[model samples]
Target chain A: QQQVKQSPQSLIVQKGGIPIINCAYENTAFDYFPWYQQFPGKGPALLIAIRPDVSEKKEGRFTISFNKSAKQFSLHIMDSQPGDSATYFCAATPAERGGADGLTFGKGTHLIIQP
Target chain B: DVKVTQSSRYLVKRTGEKVFLECVQDMDHENMFWYRQDPGLGLRLIYFSYDVKMKEKGDIPEGYSVSREKKERFSLILESASTNQTSMYLCASSRSRTGRGETQYFGPGTRLLVL
Candidate 1:
C-alpha cells in the first residue's frame, strides 16, 4: 500500500509564477514532513521540512503548508525560476522511529519552469 | 556539510551476475540508508543501519541485502543481478536523533543497468 500519495506527476509554470505540489498521507503516526528537490545528475537534496506542530514553514522562496488535521501538505515555490525546474518528492516519517528508520516517500512530481 | 558518495555513477552488468553497490558518508552519521528510485515509484527504502553491524530491512528488502561494517560505510548487494533490478540507487545519511525532524543528506546516486 502506498502510505503517502503525491499528485500531478508533472507540472509546468512560467518563470516568476508559483508552482504548487501536494501530498497526502494516510498514516496518522507521521509527524515529520519534508520536501526534497532533485536536479538532473544529482541526488535529491533537502529543500524544506515542517513538523505537525506548525501550520506552515517558509525558507526563502520555498514554502511548506501543512494541515495536520487534513493529513496533507503542499510545497510552493515562489518566483519559480528555470533553475527550480526539477523533480520534487515529499516524504514522511513517524516520530517514534526517531528519525533513524528512514522515510516513506511520494512518487515525485516533475516540475518545469518555462522561461 | 554532509557528503555521501556512491561507488559508481553508472554501471552495467549482465543478468545473474553478483552486484555490489558501496556507499560512504563523510559526516560520521550514525544512520545510513539505501533506497532505489524509479521513474514513477519514487524512492523506496531497501535497508538502513543505525550502528555498525546493525541493519534493518525496509519496506522493499526482497532480492537485496546490506552490510554495515563501519559507521561511515554501507554496502548493498544483489546476490544475482536481474534485469528488473535496473534503477537508480541512492544513499542517504542522517544524525541519529530521537525526534520528529532530521535532515537527510543524499549521494548523487548510482544508475545500474542489468542486461
Candidate 2:
C-alpha cells in the first residue's frame, strides 16, 4: 500500500519540448510527494516537492501537478534541453500521520533530452 | 545549505569481508537515511535513524545493519558481504526547520562492489 508507481521506464524528448512523468501512489496516508533528479555518479537531489493540499507547484522550469483524489502526481519539465538528461525518481512519505517513515520510491524513469 | 558526505565514492570488497559505509551530515538534522540504488529499483531504503542511537529498519534491511554513534553520523555495515550486495549506496538527511517533508539533502553516493 506504500508503493509509489512511476511510469515510462525511460523518456526521450526533443529540444524545447515538454516532458511529462507520471506517478501514482496507493497509500492515502501519504501527503508529501517529492521528485528527485540524479546524475551519473551523484545521489538523488530534491528537484521539486508538493503536498496534497496544493494542486500544483511551480519552480522555474520544473513543475509538479498533483491530484489529491486521484492519488496521482506528475512532473513536467518545460523547455527541455540536452543537459536535462538524467534519472528521475518519485518518492512519497506519510510522516505527518505517523512520526517519520522512510520514503517509498518508484522504479525510476530515465529521461533523455535531445538537442 | 545542508551537506551530507559519504566516506568513499567507490569501494571493492571480497565476498566474506566485512564492509562499512560511513555517512556524516553537517546540518545536524534529526533524520538520517541509507538507501541502495539499482537500475530498475529506484532507491530501496535499508535503514534510518531519527535520533542518536535510535534506528528503524526499512523494507530492504535484511542484509544490512546500521549504527548511529553521533547525531550527525550514520554508518551502514554488512556483516558478511556478498556478491549481490554490489550497488550504489546513498546517504540522506533532512532538516526539520521548515517542517516534515520539507526537503532531504543527499550525499554524493558511494558505489560498492562486493566480489
Candidate 3:
C-alpha cells in the first residue's frame, strides 16, 4: 500500500488566491508529516510540516492543517504567487525511528499559480 | 544551512553496466538516504544508512546496494543497470534528535539513463 496518497495531480490557481493540496496516509503509526516543494531541475525543499499532536501549523505563506483521527493533512498557500508554482509532495514517518532513516512519500501534486 | 551534494547530475550508461552514485553532506548528520524518482512513483527509497558502515534496504532495493564508509558520505551502487532503472536519484541527510521530528535536506538529483 502507498503509505501516503496525494490528491489533484495538478493544480491551477490565480495569483493572490489560495491553493490547497491534500494528502492522506494509511499508516497510523506515522507521527510526523512534512510537505516538500520541488522546482524543475532542482531538489525538493521542505516547505512545511506538522505533527499529529497539533491540528495546524503555519509558516509564512504556507500552512499545514493536520487531522489525526482522519489520518489526513493538507498544504495551503495563502495569496499564491507565480513563484509558488512547483511540485508539492507529502511525506510521513514514524517518530523515534531516527530521522532520515526512511520516509514514505506521496505522489507529488504539481501546483501552478497563474500570473 | 545543510548541503548535500551528489557527484553526478546527469549520467548515461549502457545496460548491464555497473554504476556508482556518490553523495556527500556538509552537515554532521548521522543518517543518509538514497531514493529513486519515477514519473508516477514520486520518490521511492532505495537505501539508507543510520551511521557509518551501517546500511539498510528500503522499499526498492532489489537492483541496488549501498555503502557508507564515512559519516558524511553515502554511495549507491547498481550491480547491472537496466532500462527500467533509468530515473532521477536523490540523496538526503538529516540530524537525529530525540523525540522531535526534523526535516531532511536533499541534494540536487542525479538523473541516469540506462540504454
Q: Which candidate number maximizes DockQ?
A: 1
- Mark the regions of model 1 whose C-alpha exceeds 4 Å error after superposition: none
Candidate 2, what DockQ?
A: 0.56
Q: Candidate 1 or 2, higher TM-score?
A: 1
Give the alpha carbon lDDT tens digit for every residue of A12-85 in model 1.
Answer: 99999999999999999898998999999999999999999999999999999999888999999999999999
- Each model's interface RMSD (Å)? 1.2, 2.7, 1.6
The sequence of per-residue lDDT tens digits that candidate 3 reaches over residues B5-114 is: 99999999999999999999998998899999988778999999888999989999999999999999999999999999999999999887454677888999999999
* Model 2 pairs whose backbones collide: none
Runs of candidate 2 with Cα error greater than 4 angstroms are: A97-99
How far is each candidate from the true structure, as Cα RMSD in Å?
A: 0.9, 1.7, 1.0
Better of 2 and 3 by TM-score: 3
Chain B alone, model 1: TM-score?
0.97
lDDT of 1 by residue, B2-110 (tens): 8999999999999999999999999978899999999999999999998899999999999999999989999999999999999999999998756557789999999
lDDT of 2 by residue, B65-113 (tens): 9999999999999999999999999999876633667577889999999
Q: Could you give candidate 2's per-residue lDDT for residues A18-56 as a string of tens digits?
A: 999999999888888999999887889989988888999
Evaluated on CA atoms against the true complex, candidate 3 attains a DockQ of 0.69
* Candidate 1 colliding pairs, count: 0
Q: What is the lDDT for B71 in model 1?
A: 91
